[model samples]
Target: MKLDKVNWENYYDKIKGRSPRPLLRAALELEKETSRPNGRFAIDLGCGDGTDTLFLLENGWQVLAIDAEPVALERLLAQVPTDLTKNLQTEVAQFEQLTLPPAQLIHASLSLPFCHPDSFPSLWQKIEASLVENGRFAGNLFGVNDSWAVNAHMNFHTKQSVEALFANFAIDYFDEEDKPGRSTAGSKHWHIFTIIARKMSDSSN
Candidate 1:
């Protein structure tokens, strides 16, 4: 579904100063143990306001920050520290239209659930295919019980389906939050799956 540009700006404005998502922080921590930092590439998918993108850049990773809303990218670029500008890139595109490069990590945070259900499967495949062998995906998926599950424009998953999405990868961190919570929008029941999984090499599986 097409979101109004102004509403998108307000939504992002509310979340502008938030800290990076935990899944990404954990993914980076894992990176610290398993690989060298030099020239590591990462994609910050649906990176609203660049919270996670800035974190990735500050930590020395080359970041490709993407958001469907141009205002989001504008705010992100405006806030980035000048010293870290060399390693950052930005794109304004929706999920279904994205073309990603092979990267060591992809952080989607709360983004993927917005992809239209019809296009989500193919998008998922692209994610898997774009990762280098053993590369990681750190992201969130909304569950079937989410308050917004009734919204036809958004994608929601069952627990079984969520697991199925990772059939070829090894799950590193998984959390299912199915409880009432207050969001920037208001109070509602949230069913969210936070995941960090590693792509498996064909021979390793």
Candidate 2:
């Protein structure tokens, strides 16, 4: 399938009932080990239909859910339980123009790869800077061999490149998958990286 030809509306509908991404689940479990209090905040980049945002809000995190599509934000807001609405904030912004706030967790799922390549470095820098020291980042990135890698607008990385992006992070979990898979778009060869890393303190860095 051509990356440019994906039908995002259909894709969103397809994943509306899916479970939260494993990267998010792992990050939550690992962060819980620190015994940090709840009511902390998270930024859900590319929140889509709010599947993950709903999970975070239910878990007691104040969430700022962002997506480039207004419809995506609408879907997210609609699914949020009424009692959980106070803890939720929604934003419609593109990665290139986004301004991030400090957060205990930055969860992106499989969204970051769609960032225009020219903007991705700056966007990543923002992500890193917005995280509090010892804060966690849970996300997926497209690998160099991903079928969609040929799309000039998307960012794909080598293992070395991905590791280099985490130089200031204390990585606790890193896994790669090169297999056949189905995405919201369609069936394709997936070369992906799943990461759970904690930002290190200035002195530690």
Candidate 3:
């Protein structure tokens, strides 16, 4: 789908007041086991409506919230508590145009699938390069069998391909679901891979 065709403002309003994705909450829970500082930085790729972004800030994380839609950034910035403003940064940029900074955590939620198939490899490579040692990546990828897989603009993966994407990371959390579901876009069959993986050292930390 053309980025301009998306009704981002309306989409954000539709999901307003909802909690952050469980995948993000799980990633944060895993962080508690480590000795990382609460003030460590995280990146929220394709952060919509600021739910995950606000959660990160509330927990003392410094966050760089990025989304392609200007309205997305505007809504996110507007909802940020005044005191937490210093903890947050907003960027308006697309997946293909992004150059991520190294971070302790990167959360994308239900966003990466929108990346064009041809650009996904390079974007994924950039994601890997942007993580600090032992950092975590939490997000969902649409599966090949998803109803939306027929859309030529979106990227969908089979299990083997998804596993290959995380070959260098330790799979901390992984769930595959194929079922009927509702999205902001409308009702659809959802075949998705929910993942949270930690970057591993050579010794496999």
Best candidate per TM-score, number?
2
Cα lDDT of model 2 by residue, 1-205, tens digit: 4578656677798876899888788888887775555447999999888899999998889999999989898888888889999999999999988999888899999899999999999999899998888888999999988989889989999999999999999998999998899866668889999999999974332
TM-score of 2: 0.94
Of candidates 3 and 2, the better by TM-score: 2
lDDT tens digits by residue: candidate 1, 1-205: 2232337677787886788887888999998877644358999999887888999998989999999998888888988999999999999988998888888899998889889899999889888888888899999999988888877888999989999989889989999999989777778789999999998874331
Full-model lDDT, candidate 1? 0.86
Q: Number of clashing residue pairs in every model? A: 0, 0, 0
Model 3 segments beyond 4 Å from truth?
Answer: 1-4, 37-39, 202-205
Q: What is the RMSD of candidate 3? A: 2.6
Instruction: Give candidate 3's whole-model lDDT.
Output: 0.88
> Model 2's lDDT to the true fold?
0.88
| Residue range 63-181, candidate 3, lDDT tens digits | 99999888888888888899999999899988987899878999999999988889999899888888877889999999988988878888999999999999999999999999998
How does candidate 3 fare on TM-score? Answer: 0.93
Cα displacement (Å) at residue 196, model 3: 0.6
Off by over 4 Å in 1: 1-6, 36-38, 202-205
| Preferred candidate (lDDT higher): 1 or 2 | 2
TM-score of each: 0.93, 0.94, 0.93
